[model samples]
Each structure stands twice: as C-alpha cells, then as structure tokens.
Target: MSTPKPATEATIRANRAVRDALPFDDTTDIENADRGLIVRATGQILTDEGDVAWDFDRWSFLDGEAPDTVNPSLWRQSQLVSKAGIYQVADGIYQARGFDLSVQSYIRGEKGWIVVDPSISVEPTKRGYDLVCEHVEDLPVTAVIHTHSHIDHYGGVRALVTDEAVASGDVRIIAPVDFLEESVSENVMLGNAMARRKAYMYGEIVGYGPDRAVGAGLGQVTSAGTVTLIPPTDIISETGTELTVDGVRIVFQHTPGAEAPAELCFYLPDHKALCGAEIVTHTMHNLYTLRGAKIRDSLIWSKHLHEMLQLFGDAEVLFSSHHWPTWGNAELRDLIASQRDTYRYLHDETVRLANKGLTPVEIGEQVNLPDALAQKFSSRGYYGSTNHNVKSTYVYYLGWFDANPANLHPLEPTDSAPRYVEYMGGADAVLERARDDFEKGNYRWVAEVLNHVIFADPENTAARELQADTFEQLGYQAENGTWRNFYLTGAMELRDGIRKQHVLVTASADSVRAMSVSMFLDYIAMRLKAPEAVGLSAKFAVVLPDIDERYVLELGNGVLNHHPGTADDVEATLTFDRSVLDGVVLGTTDIAEAVERGDVSVEGDAHTVRSFVQLLEKFEFWFDIVTP
Candidate 1:
C-alpha cells in the first residue's frame, strides 16, 4: 500500500475556508438522522471468498474530524451518509441504507410488503430484504416498484422475488413506462466505455481512505455482485397514475427525462410519505453523469422538481433512493425547493453566459450557485460539481460545437500533439514551463500542457511524473467525489501504467434474458465493423419460436437494419430459442457450436451468417484514457 502525499498548505486553507463558511452549527441533519432508528447493520457485504464488494468500514475515517487531505464540507456530508442500516422512515415505511448505491424501501401493507428500488445487486438486496424481514414481520414481497430505469434502482429484482412469481401474477413488478427498454438499452450500446469510466466515477478501482475513496456522495460505493433485472408486470405510464398494493394507496408522478429517461416519483397518500426516487437526492444530482451518458435536460429537471413540490407538498416526509428521508412537511418542501433552484439556476445562468458568446469552459468558470442554494447542504456539489453541470447545460442547448470554425474540425490528439510540443520548444521546454505552473498551484494549465508533452512523446518520464503530481494536488482539493477519483485514477495510471483487470462490460444474465430480440439486434448493429461490412450485403431471417417473433435482418451500405416479420428471399433462415441467441451474444456459447449441436436450425446458406458474425468487433474493456 502506498501512502498518499499530505495535503498542501493551499489545499488545507481552502478546506478550512469551506468549513468556516458552512453552517456547521445546524442540527437539522442530526435530528433527521436520529429519526431513522437502526434495526440491523452490516458494515461490509462480502463474496463467498470474503472479498469485499461494498464496505462501510472504508468510510470509517468519516467518524473522526475532517483531515487536512479532505474537504470539510464533503467530510461532513460523508459522515451523514455513512450511517448504514435498516431504519424506520415512518410507522409503516422502512429503508435499508448503505447496502448498495441506492436504498431499498419497504412499505408494510395489510398482508405483505411493497419493495421499492431494491438496490444494485443480488447479494446486498437479499441481505437487505432479510434485515427488513427481521425487523418487520416476515412477509412475501407483494410488489416491486422500480422508480426509474437506473440499474441501482431495479437491478436486484430477482433476489426479492422470482420471475415465475411475476409471470404467474403472484407478485407485481411495477415500473415507469419504457423502464424495461430504457433500463437494458441505456448501458448496452456504450457499456464497455461506460463501465471503464464508472470505475473512476465511483472510485471502484481506488482504495478507501481519507485521501483516497471516501464516499461517492450518493452512497459509500457501488456493490459488485450478480446484477439482475425482471421485466415489470405493471407500467406506470401517465402522471396521476394510481395503484393499490396490498391495501396501500400510491400515486405516481412521471418525471421522465428529468433524472433519467424513464423516471417517476410516487406519493404514499395513506402514510403521507413521498418517495422522490433519484430525481431528488440529498446532494445535487448530475445533469450529465461523469461516466458519459446522454446529457440530461436541466430545464426539464428543474420543472419536475417544481412539479413534485406542487403535487406532493402536503406529504410530511420525503425519502429518496440514495439518502435518508427528510421529515416534516416544511423541511421536505424546503429540500425540494432548494434542489429545484439549484438546477434552474445552473440552466438559466449557463444559457445566459452562452448567449453572451462564452464557450462551455468559460461558462463553467463563470457560473456559481446563488448564496441561498449554495448555503444549503442539499444543494451543494458533493456528487455533481457546478463546473461540469454548467458545461452540460451549455451542451444540452448548443452541443459540442462552439460555433468557432477553428474548433470545427480539429486534428486528432496524436496528429496535433507533436506540433504543440514543437511550438512550445519541445517536451523538455514544455515540462519546464509546466513545472513552474505546478509550483504556482496552476495545476489545470500544467495538466493541459503536460498532456501534449506526454502525447507527443509518451516515454517522457519527467513530464508524466509532473503531470501525475499536478493531478494529485487537484484531487486533494476537489469537493466532489467523482472529480477527486478521476484525478487520482488518472495520476495512478500515469505513474504505474494501466492496471490489467477484467471489467464487467456485459449486462447480467437476467438483464440479457429480459432484452427483446429487437433490442439484441440493435446491440449487434452497434458492434458491426463498418469497414469490414462496407459494400457487403446480406439478408437473414431469425425465428424465435419460443417468443413467437420473427425478424428479417438486412446488412448493407455499412448499416445493419432489422424489422419484424421474416422474408422468403434471404441468404439464410435461422430458428432458435431466444436463450440461444442470448448465449451467443453473451459469448457463453459459440454460434457454430450451437448449430453443430442442432440447437440452432439453418434452412439456407450458413456461410453468410458466419460472415456477418465475423464482421462484429468485440470491444476491449481496458482501453486507455488520459493517455495516448
């Protein structure tokens, strides 16, 4: 284990300044913390070999006073979120926190319990469910409500209830409209890239310490286990949708394109509690997540927060998928209002700056939360920083193009770096200048210049060391956990080179099984090597007798198209169960082997099918980032 460098004087002063500015005397958070009495606690969720997945002990540093290496405001928030266990939210409502990236809520009904957002993986979800059963009466899960399409919310469905129970109508699996499609598809297309980025975003690869991985600002960290998904039996499509599960009345408020592409907030009218989902977390949620996804609409996100306040203002308590519940009608309303203002301000101010001819970087530098929103802990940028959110806001409206023709078609990094280094008097000269900037605490500029030097000549060990040191300083000062992790991870990669580890790029077995044939085809289309498939044309018909769906696939002009119904005029016709295709896609079974085993039937030419399969490019999960 390597000991991290101590915080610099500048970083220590900055942390102290933040601590001095915040209202540390406020006891509201403490009061709210006390309300949720713990029923059970497990600090670590381990695998069969005792390998830790999600460890609360990693954040035990939060128990003490803030160290000079950590931002005090973030440390305070970490301490609050570090409280992990099953806790009573209300008379009939309970929640399991610290089990995963998201919380699992259990609403006690007349006969059974309604499970809401069952965490990220099977092991933690099962443990949480068992804890709930121990505290409350052991009852079958009557219904499972997935508030949004995010994996952390609904990926653990199989642990609490079986697909057979849902299929047989013995249990209800409820979710937002398009939940099944969005949940599976969101992470599939660019999943390998996202999974790699997620390691940095969640600090999964980084060790836990005060100077390392403290907390994700949402939860401790993501739980690693078998991620599962069960298709929803009930879809809440429209706003004002009402459902009663085991005599508990619930009203759904659809907030799609707010936090997620498919998301909803629900009000338990009988209990006077509102489940805000991920839409309204305790910390400022991301408008554009660091792990690369579609840019979220900040305007629409703000609008939905206002909508939640308007629709469920009367509710006395508010609970979200990540954090502890807020009690009292006044406090809940205030929390919603603050979060609403945070997004709205980011949106309006960013556009205001962009209209004045400012670029994304310029806007990011200029925008800051108003004093009212900034003062509140709920609106602080613990997860999503104001700098990135402002840039995301600019991108949401104008996009990557800054309208500057100079940047319209820039040279690739490799092509551009050599020239940049030459212009800056070669690699040594650039490093000398960067070292000066590093000494002056101009880490950002040092990083920018050193990047060109590294790309120009990767063997420049001095430039790499200086750049890594600069990143360490920046990481030490970052209040946002993701930002801190990204910097640290980049530095580690620069110093030690890329760590060879097998990252989980593919979706879980259950999630793959739930994917429709059309969805699977879409994934295949994405993986097609355009260069290999160029000018090559082929047509194939796929018949899944089990699902009773037939699709005609056409590959031509570097594009793969699929449509419902089969055609007689085709190169080949393949018939098989959906599971066989799933196995092939997941790389568990070879297509030729399945065909040889007679599991897959081919009525026409098989060479064309093999050719098409050969054209698909398998993604390398550990592709380098922050380097050439």
Candidate 2:
C-alpha cells in the first residue's frame, strides 16, 4: 500500500497538450465497435478457492476520460479493450477478448468449431470456451490454429481440448513452420532473466491505479494460471498454404521475424475475414520487446504487411489475436496500410539516419513520424515508442558496435559509476545539480545524473529518493504501457527494495512435457556451475525409453555437451521414461527418489549422476534488477 506521488503542473500541462494534439473527436474506433457485440460480460473468473485468474474489472478507471497521470490516447485504447466477453466477429467467426493477454477466436465449421490462438493460460481459455459454448451450440473442437510461437498465442491449448483427443485423430492442431522449436526454446534459454524483466514490463508487481498499472496496450494484463502447449500436428510451411478444417477454408500467409519469430496470418474465403494474429494489432508492436529478445527485422515486418495487403485486400472484415475487430473492406485496408507505412517509415528512416553517421541515440532523438502516420490511431506508440524502436532498427542491421573505438570496450556500470561521481565533484555535488534539474522539470536528466550517485553509493538515501521521484514523473508521462511499468517498477524497487516473492516462468505441466530433449539439455547447460565443473571431466549415456531417444553427455572444461548417440564406454548409463526425466528437470521429483521408486534405472555407477547433479545450480526467480 504505497501511495503514488501526484503529477506536477508540468506533467499535467504535457498531458493536456497531448490530448489537444490528438484526434480525440475521432469516433471511428467507437463506430468500429459495431462489428462485434458482446454476448456476456463479467468482472472476474475465479479458481476453486476464489482466487482471481482473470479480472476484467481491474481497469474500470478507463471508463471515464483519461486522468492527468495517463495518456489520453492510451486511455481510449484501454477503454476499447476493457470490454470483456464473447463477441460475434462475423457470420461464422466469434471472438473472446479481455479474458487474457490475447483473444481466442472460434470459427463454426461443418462438424465442429475451429479455435484460433487459445490465449495464455488454462483458466482464462476454459472460461472463454465456456462463454463461447453458451452463445453457440455445444460443438466439439475439430481444429486448433496457433498463429505464432509466443506463449500467449498457443499456451492454453490443453484447456480447449485434451492431448488424448488430438492423438486419437479426433482433432487437429495447426501452426506455422518451426512453431514447436521456437515455442519450446524461445524463452527457455534466457527464461530467468526474461521472466524477471517481464514482471516489470507487464506491471505484475505493481498494483492497479491511475498512477500505476492501467493497461498493457494489448490487453488489460497477462492472465496468471496454467500455461499449456500442444505441439501442432499440421505445420503451415509456406505462404498461400490452404487448409479446410471441417467446412471453413483458410489461406495461410507466413510472416516470420515480424512480430514473432514464427508467425502466420490466415484469410477465410467463406467468411471474408482475415485473422492477422499479432502482426496487425491495434497498437504499434515492438521491434525489440523490453523483456529482452533478439531485435526483430523491421524491413521484413513492413514487407509482410505489404504482402498481407496484396493477399487479403479483398476481405471485408479483420480480426486480430488482440484487440477488437475492424470491419469494412475499405476501413480494414486503410488500417493495414497505415500499420505498413509505420514500420516502413521507422525502418527506412532509421537506416537513413544511421547512414548519415548519426548514432542510435541521436537518430532516436531526431526521427519523428510524418503527420500522416502519426495521426493514425492504429499506428500510435501506446505499446512501442519511436525512441526505442529506432535503436532496435539500428541494432538489427548494424548490431551493438557503433564503429566508435572508445565505446568498443567500456567499463561496466558498477566500475564506472564511482568514477563518474568523482568527476562530477563527488556525490553531494552531483545530487545538488540533479536537484536543480529536477526542480526545472528536467526529470530525464535528473534520473541520468542521480543514477550515477545511487550506483556509486547505494546507501545514499537522498539520492535514492530523488531518483525515485524523477522516475515517478517519467512514468507518469509515458504513453507506452511497458515504458510506464518499467519506470514505475524501478521507482518502487528503489523505495521498497527488490521483492522476494517467486514469479512463475512456465505456465503449465503440458509445456514442461512438450519440451524437446535438446531443449532440456540446453536448460541443464545453463544451470551448470562453472566453478564446480572446472576440472571435472565426465561422460554419461541417457536413455529415454518412452520417446526412444538416446544421448551421450560429455562434461569437460566447465562445459556440458549433449549429442544424439549411445556411449557404451561411459562411466554411468541411466535409463528412464521421458515423463520421469521431465519430473526431475521440473523439480517435481528428486532423481534419487525416482530411482528408489523404480521409475529410473542406473547401470554401471550411480555416483556419477549425483556428482553431476550437485554441480548444477538452481536459479532464484526473484533476482535484483534496478540495484546491484
């Protein structure tokens, strides 16, 4: 129960100027609401103990006009997305939005319903499915379509239908090429760090308020529950791929390295609808997400948008994995065209500036969209701002090196902060100057200067308080939800210290089971304690009887390598079912206990397995971020 600081006069005036500049009177978004009508609306969906998994009413502040602390444009978008429940997108297509981070669509087919992008978790997906069932006839799901590799797009598959049903050939799971590989390995490698940053990016640690978490631009917030993944039975490998599930016809268009590493859009010929998935959402997407991943290819993203215009321009209605649907051929086309131009403009202009010998920071400060692209509600920076996107573009093409020898190898933050403080005439002098800047409404500069003081001497209470106050002002002014969350979360950590609570990384047991053997090996490699494994040289053979897979594991020079094959000369050979292996990896059961329970068999020597296990370090989820 921390109280947020009130917005200053400067911040209020800035927000008002933003309000006056935008087309607040534009009613097209409201008018577009007519395309779909909500069938049912509820506040929250609870588990057996009355724990809330999905709460649509948390964002009720958006019902009125934007507050002084929030961007008016973002408020409008939040209001639009806050409308929860099942909606009819078209004759055959229905959508369930506001239940999770992404929408779940149901297309009525000849035999049953075809579900698209079943959201992030089991509880919300099941709730959405029940709502769909209430509106339409009770129909079995014939097919499930996953548009991309992101967890929000495909994590809730098991909630819709069982794996048993999919295995029995009663239902089909469809996704783009490399979907399983991308889905399993995408977050697993950098999962701990990414999950920590994701908590800040999504405002999961912050409470909801006018000054705190309001909306995530894409949705209210990510739902917390069991995340499950069912591997796709049919992979859409190429553009113009056609599939007819039940009676509905779909034309898939692959658009990788756009919004996601593996993504596709589908055009419905019968319903005259296009499922643009995450590629074409209401807000401008991240070329580089704040939660840390490889920078996306903006050039390829723009190209895909143009391709979508060419492939599905005739469609009269459009629905995305997030946000509401857009109707009318002319309107849908305009929306797509505007989004296309936004990315193209960002990419081309960023490159142009870079070629002119400007650094990424300079380019970010210099580049501004033309009024044409800027005025479009769909192209607004409520999710991804131009400042960061410009840097992402530069890094995607040129990488982190900027051809500056001085910056090629710079001192780390901790090493440089004390030197910076000394050069600025010590922490007291730096704090005095930062306070002057803070008073002049130069909060950004204040944050920059005071950060050095805080890092140089973390026990300086005055510097910490000043830095937190500066970040509060910056958070109040941010239009992008993630930016606001990051700033505010940083401020919260500064004031109250890092939270010790555990954050869930994986969503469900199904996702754990769906992991490939290679992915498991990668996870183990990350956990290997370098100091402990320094002089250890060991070899082992792992046999998974259930999946009929064998791997030879070698450990040397503080590194572990796993390759497909059986090593009969290994020091130890372990045989177990894949499920038992999964249980050990996921910490559901101990390896020694499993061996005692006859779930795992050890041949040759059991001491090697114990020695290897002892060298692995388990990561603590709640690691410090803002502070050292």
Candidate 3:
C-alpha cells in the first residue's frame, strides 16, 4: 500500500530509450485528423459502449485508488484508440475503430465490396459491414481477405460471409498459401498455454479503465466474440499473384518470415494503395509477442519491408489492420522506409553486439537505434519496443545460453530465493532496506528486492504488498500503454494473487472443432498430469465415424505417444467425428450421453477408453485465483 522509491539509473535509462524508440506525437496528430472521420462513419451512434478507451481504460489498474494509478503515457494511447466509432480512411474504404482491433473494408468497382481484415468479433465485423453500407451503396460482399493469421485479423469471417453464402460458393475467402496451417499452429497447437499467457499479456484479469486496460499497443483490444474460421477458398501462392475480384486488382506479396509465418501484404494498382497487413503497422509489432511464440526474425522482417518498398513505392494510400491510414505517397514512402530501417537497425545491431560475444542483457544495454531512425514517428515502438525487439533478435540468433557457463547451471527459484535473502543479510534487513528505497522512489529496486523476499516465502504478505506497490508506481510512469498495463497488472496480481474467475472465453467450439485429430491428441497429452498418469500403460485406437480416419494413442510412463495410422493390438477403439469430441470438451454432452445418443460409438474395450478419459484432468474455467 506504499509507493516504491524513485526510479533507478537503469530504469530511467530504459524509459528514455522507450521514449526515443516510440515518440507519442504521431498518435496525437492521427487522433486529431481522424476524430470527425470516425464519428461520421458510424451510422448508429449507439452509446459509446464500443469505445476502446472505455473497454480498456487504465483506471481499473489502479482499482480503488483511481487518481493515483493513472499513467499519462497510457492515457494518451487510450485516448487515441478510444476516440469513438468508425472512420473513413479513403473513398470507398471505411473502418470501424474501437469496436475490436480496427476493421477496414474496401469497395470494389462493381456494386460489391471486399472486406479486408474484419473486426475480431461477429457483431463488430457486422457493424463494420453495416457502417460501410450506410455510407456507400449496399452491395454484396464478393470476397473476404484475411491479411494474416491472427485471430483478431480474421475471426470475424462469419459476419461478412454467412454459412449459406460460403456453402453456395457466393463468397470467396482469400488468404496466403499456408494461412490455415499457420493459424492452427499459432492459435491452437499450444493454445491453452498461449491463452493463459495472453491473459497476462492483455491484463484480462484486471478490469478495463485508464489505470488498467491500455492494451498490448496493437489496437484498442481483442474481442472475445464469436470466432469462426472457414478455410480460404483462394490462396495466393506466388510472389506477384494478382487477384482481380469485383474489378479490383490486388497484387499479393507474401511476407512469411516477418510477423506471422503465413502473412501477406497486398498492393492495389487501381487505387495505388498498399495494405501492409500486420507486417508494417503504424506501431512496432512484437518480434517477440508477449503471448509467446518462436522469436520472430527481425532480419527477415526488415528484408520483407524492404521488398514491400520496392513493390509499392508509389502507393499514395497506406492502411494497416490496427491504426489510421497514411495518406499521400510521400508520407507512405517515408513510413514504410522508416519502419523497414527500424527492424533492420534492431536486427543488424543486435547481431553486431552478439558477434562481439556480448550476452543478451549486455546486448540489450548496448543495442539502440541510430538517432535518425529513432526520431521517426513510425519507427517508434508502441506495440513492440526496440528493447524487447533487440533482446528477441539476440535470442533468435544466439539462444538463451549467453555463453556463460556459470549461468548454464544456475540455481532454481526455490534454492535461489533463500540464498538471496540470506546474502542480503536477512528477510527483515532486506525488507527494511527495500522499504527505505521505496520511500526514495526507487520503485524498480524495491520491486527487485521484495521479489526475492516473496520467492523466499510466498506467504509473506508484507513483501508481496511492497513489491506490488513498487510495480504500481513503475506502471504509473510508463509511456507505452502495454508496459503500463503489464506493470499495473503485475501489481494487482501480487496484491490479490490470481483471479481465474475473470476468465474470458478463450476458444469456442468452432475453433476447437477445426482442430485436427493430431492437435486434439497433443492437447490431451499436455493435459495429462504426469504424476497421476504415471505407471499406467494404456493404448487405444480412436476411429471417427464421420471422418474416414483412426488414431492410435499409447499412454505409457506418463507420456502419450501417438501413432496416427492405427494399432491392431490396441486395447480400445473409440469412434466419433470432431463434433462429438467438441461436445464432450464443451460439456454440452457427457461422454455417456453422447454414446447413448449415437453421437459417439465405442467398439472393442469401452472401459479402457473410459478409464483414459477419467484419468484426463479437466481444468476449472473459473477458479478463484485472488483467494489464498
């Protein structure tokens, strides 16, 4: 409940770098220019229930102490993202802002439109479609283009194209060649872990407000709306594969290495417009997304941008998935070039430092953007900062070892915590010193010291409270909304432990149903408690009635080894389509009921399959995390 001490030299230096990396002026100007544009584009001015600022305000980070928790930098970002309604980026192109991420659609030559990157939710994507229709002549949607393989970018496919339309072949869904594969890998393969990490990354447990929900800096926020994924009808395979849909010529330039593994930016020849997809956004996207992934290749990312520059150098209008569009060829060129150089600088410099045998931390300290690139507004880090990107570049090439043998076999958390406390004289001495430092406003140091104390004894409320206070003050000082949200959220978690009851709908049945049998079995493997499943050897062959396939799973020594083809000697054979499995997972239909209802049919040893299912642990969707 006490504020931490002053910022340390390192903290101050990092903040300065963060400021230099992402200047706030760009957002200010964009907000001013697009203010009226957003308001006018929305046909129904429903109560600003859809404001990004309202949904992700930072006030909730402060909780009860609303005034003190407000961070100026976060407030500014929220103001820009929350400035209300849809916006007109260009003639025939309108975007629904603040609803969820930013949905932008382009009108084709005929009395039809092509929706580019629908909002995260069905309701918002529908709203965006309606907003465009309200302004322009209402027309049939000819195509839905998914720029990349992110949930927010393509989750709203259903809103634009109904099931009937898709089934009837009236609507064409276009995307990169490996879009579906990449989407599954990123969002589903490790979905549970990613979902958990995303909760922390977006501060999902904390209520939305000025002090709490500034966002991950990509956009206003992610919508947990109906997520529907229909496989792409048209896939752009070649580099310059052009698609002429509804009289609009779209030249797709695939950028696989950068951003998502399967992402492409397209050039509109007719309009001289370039849709950068999620590659070169208004803000610096994460090379190492906090939600977790393989560290992105900054070098490859920069190279892709360089290629885009040559491909769309004369593009007069530049638009992205998140933020306002850039008008004029001059600004477009400048923005693209600057962002390209930003990544190049991080990549080249990080490698330079790494080649010199500097460790990741050491490289982080030394790596910085040149003054020219750092000063550019677009080069600034809003979504992804230079510091983290530098670390990412380092890790991507060198791995986490850092070439230090001493660090190779470092003490684990449990062993190190007590040693740290003892080395610092004692728990009381460390707490006293940290408290004194806190009074001096050295919040970073206070948090660091108290973190050791808590690790020493997690039950120590005083240490936890002090550390939480330290995090709050640091959060209050952050310029980047993500940093502020992360710090403040950390403080809240420390103070109130976890709040699992605040669970958001992570994956719907639609998403789960799309999962391949291999993915499902992988998830089951992950869910198995090693200790509980230990010493139990079980083999079962699961056959799908609807789909012509059977999977053999061997559970032995707490490891679930899968043989997709089949195992003749397997003890049990369970048969069902993907939907039946989904029904069981969603708790809509119990296994017994499913069998009785003919949704699921079991042949061979049913008891073995039942035993395996019983041994599988189901995670509580809404556990009381804040409670001790």
Candidate 4:
C-alpha cells in the first residue's frame, strides 16, 4: 500500500497563499486623541494560560477602511478589550485593560478596594488585581458593584472577593434591582441551549491561533471557572440613589432597558469619576445578542446615554467594564455623545426606512453610519456590526416581518437545504467548483457554496473539509475578534462536527448550596416538557422542610404554573429539602433513589407525582455529530 504524501511546505505555502491573497488589515492607527496619556499604550500582554496571542497595534487600525476595518463598531470594541493593562484615570480610580476585557475598579479607603467589574474570568481578573496591587498598596475588597448582568462584566467576582467576606459583612455586593433575578433566569433556564449557542457566538469551540482566534470582540474569550451567585446586600432600586462604600461616595443613575434589563451607571462626586458598566461602552453594544435574548431597546438605550451626558457632563474620568477609560472632561463628554448619537442614528434611520415601506434587508442596506459618527472610534461596531444592528433596531421596533406577504409562509431549513443543493447541481459538481474557488482564494464564494452542501448532507467529509478550509481562511483574515471567532468556530464544527457538551451538568457545590427554595421550584418549572404536558392536567403540592413554604404546581395545556400559597386540592404532596432537589437537577440520583434513601418523603398520592416524572425528558449530555 502506498502512503499519502505528507503535508509539504508547498501545501502549507499553498494554504498560506490563499490566506495572503485574501483581504486583511495592512496598517496600524493608534493615534487616538488621548493616546499614550488617557488611554496608555502598553502594547499587549500574553495571557497567562498562554493559550492565546495578543496584538494591540494590528487591532487599533482606523486609518484604512474596508477589510482593514471589518466593522467600525467591532474595531472600537476591540480597543476596549485589547487596550493597555493599567492606567490612573483619576486620583483614586484606576482601570486595568488587556488584563481582560476592560476590567475597571475603584480604590477606596486606603486599605479597601471597591471593584466595579472584574474581567471575563478568574485568571485574567487575578492578573488585573495583581497589576493593580503592584502599583498601589494591596487592598482588601470592601464591596463589589455589578453594573449589569452580562457574563464578562461579573464573571470574575470570585477572584476579587469571597463569600466569607460577604458573610462576615466585611464586603458588600451591590447590583441594580432585579439584576439577580434577570441574570439567574437568563443564564440558568436556558443554560444548556445558551451554552451551545455561546460556543458558536463567542467562538469558544475553536482553538486560539492566528487562523482560529482573535477574540469574541468583547474579550479574548470567557475563561472556564467557578460561577458563584452571591445575593446583593443592597440593590439600586431607584435612579439617583446616593450611597457610600468604604469612604467612596457614589451617585447612581439607573439606566434600565439601555443595556441589560437592570443596568445602572454611577458617578463619584469627590473624584468626578464615572463608571458606565456595559451601558455606554467604547463600541456599539448588541441590540440583539447572537446567542439569543429579548431584543434590546436601542431608542431607550440612546435616550439613557443622552441622560448620562447631562448627568455626568463634568465627570473628569470615565471608565467602563468592556473598554479602556477616557480621562479629561472634554474627551469623556465627546466619547459619551458620540456613542449616544450613534444609537440614535441607528434607531431613527431604521424607523425611517421602515416607514418608507422598506423591508428589513432593504432597511439595513439603506442605513449607514454618518461619516462623522463612523469616523469616531468609539461609535464603531467592533462587537456589533452596523448591518446586524440596523436589522436589530428594526426588529426591536417592528416584529420579524417586512410587511411582505410572500414571506408570510416560508420553507424551513430542512425543506430548503436539499432543494437549494439540487438547484445548484449535485454534490460532486458543487464540490469541484468550490475547491477551485478555494484554490483561487475566493473563500467567500466557497463558503456560500459549501453551506448548501453541508446543510443538505452534513456528513460529507469532503464537503465539510472544503468548507472548513474556507472558514479558516476567513477567520485568519478577520480583524474583529468576534468575526474571527465566528469563522474559526464554523471551521471547527465543519471539521470535528458539533459536540453536545453541557458545562452546567455538574453544578458547583456553592451554586447548588446557594440555590433558594423559590429558585428550585422555578428550575423544575423550566424543565417541564411542554409537548408532553400538552392536554395533560396534573397538580402537585411540594413542601420545603427548612423554608416551611407550601407550593402548588399546576400542569395543563403545556403550561406549568406555580402558586406560592397552598391550592384548594392537590393530587399529590411531596416533601423534600432543597438539597435533594438539587441532586435531581444535577442528575446525580433518580427520584426513586432519593425516596428509597429516605432523603425525600411522600404524602398523599405519591404515584401521581412519580408519574409526572415520567413525563419529564432527560436531555442527552453528549451527542455524536460527525458520525450522525
């Protein structure tokens, strides 16, 4: 048997040539108005894990357009994620960037640190803390302020402080009212599906390399670490709430519906410093995140930013969780105004195009960032592209329709995939043409063609490999971290196929221990198999031993409703502590085993509740995609 030829330099060079021929950035423009001063340029620091490479100069490209800047918003967002490590924005306030996605914290009372947002992960968060500790005297964390409910903004909480601090009342956790509920509901209820989509949306599936990763544009990538939920000791329930932590006075401005559902900004009267959280970041934030969520209100977002401008017009230092800090009143004001107006433009033009009877696609095409707004680095869409944001803005105001009756009923993906492939010609013919285009470095065309092939028959290795190669080239050429991750992740999926891994399958002892009785019932409600419950009627009363709260759950017509108080009649009454329920959710034990082990007690008709468990579906922890 003859062995296949090894991958030669010629083959490597051939791949290299394709990557080289593709359009990519060829210039560096770091000459921001506040360069080397307010936004210090310390170049780049390698991640401690050494899993990824960082390039600062290449990221701050603004002098050129087109491929050099994948999207203006993306470029500006990358600036925040990849900016310098540390700088003194005010006398007592400091920001540590590049330590991980714009981690900014406030130094208070000589020995205590009041952290605003810790980076994206524990490692980088610790790295940032070390950097801060090196410059100033290391301080114990007296308080933590979570500005919003995004993973990157608060994922590093464990690194900054511990629950011991909270228990001892040495440290206080503060967040906007409803922040905890919103965060828990969003992350936990849909964690499995959201995690899968996030693997694509954030490019976590792809390896970090020149052709595989730049970052997710928000940050390099979220680090895998402990996720702890410490309840807020104090919630910012109202706008303009005044509070002081460790001798640092803060005036809070609640900006709901601007970014996260419950988000706020705070200004320090003494230092004249401001923390925008994710609300008014350096780049255009998502009107709709790719992973999935309710569409954000851009109109409300813009109005809130405008309010911030008036509220903190005299703020000397402005910092945020996802980007570098801006110092000086004039520069800070300009940054705020530019971001505020950009959202306004996106919202107004989208509505304007919609009023003209333009479809979503047409509306997106008709809208463009005004030159002035486009030129400003802060207004660019490093994380959120203009095209997507335009469509998102329309979607926010108008529902998912163009008022075109033709689109009223559309073919689903499975029905359309094979038809598209057949119309374009058979697999062999399409593959030959795509391979030729790949050789010609027309990756965009190659990708477009292979998409049909894969959708039609995802198991075709030849088609998958060809498409993977094309996506790799695009990933390599992409300047935006999010774009790079998108392309690279697509390539990885094409090559290795999708993996059905659930990160939340194994719950942390802390997250489980911290789980509340109400929260447990909510989790079970989310697990209800809607289809199975359809046309079925059942009622069960559940009792928590410690809390002494009686709850009734009604399942009928594919809906599960929970009542805090007792119901008139329940078919079965089940009694168990919260820990036993956590074990069930974590898949550590069967319902019967818990009952057998005396961990749970059944009262009344136990068989009815047991029968309900049969209706519940257990999702697979892993699935074989490539073989399938």
Error at 42, model 3, angstroms = 8.2
Compose the digit string of candidate 4's lDDT tens values, residues 74-173. Answer: 4334434555556666677776666554465756654588888765556556666776777765777888898987665666678788778898889988
lDDT of each: 0.84, 0.84, 0.70, 0.68
Candidate 4 Cα outliers beyond 4 Å, as residue runs: 1-80, 83-86, 120-123, 162-164, 432-449, 476-479, 499-519, 584-598, 620-628
* Model 2, residue 574: C-alpha shift (Å): 3.0
Give the 10-residue window scoring lowest on summed lDDT in candidate 1: 500-509
Greater-TM-score candidate between 1 and 2: 1
Per-residue accuracy of model 3 over 138-240 as CA lDDT, tens digit each = 7878888988877887777787887688778888888888887777667655566677766666766665655465665667566655667788889987789
Choose 1 or 3, whichever is better by TM-score: 1
Query: Per-residue lDDT of 415-459 in model 2, one digit per residue for the tens?
Result: 899999999899989988898888788998888888888878888
Error of 2 at 394 (Å): 1.3
TM-scores, all candidates, are: 0.96, 0.96, 0.88, 0.83
Per-candidate clashes, comma-separated: 0, 1, 21, 10
Better of 1 and 4 by TM-score: 1
Model 3 worst lDDT run, 10 consecutive residues: 57-66
- Clashing residue pairs, candidate 4? 72-380, 72-381, 73-380, 73-381, 73-382, 74-381, 74-382, 74-383, 75-382, 80-323
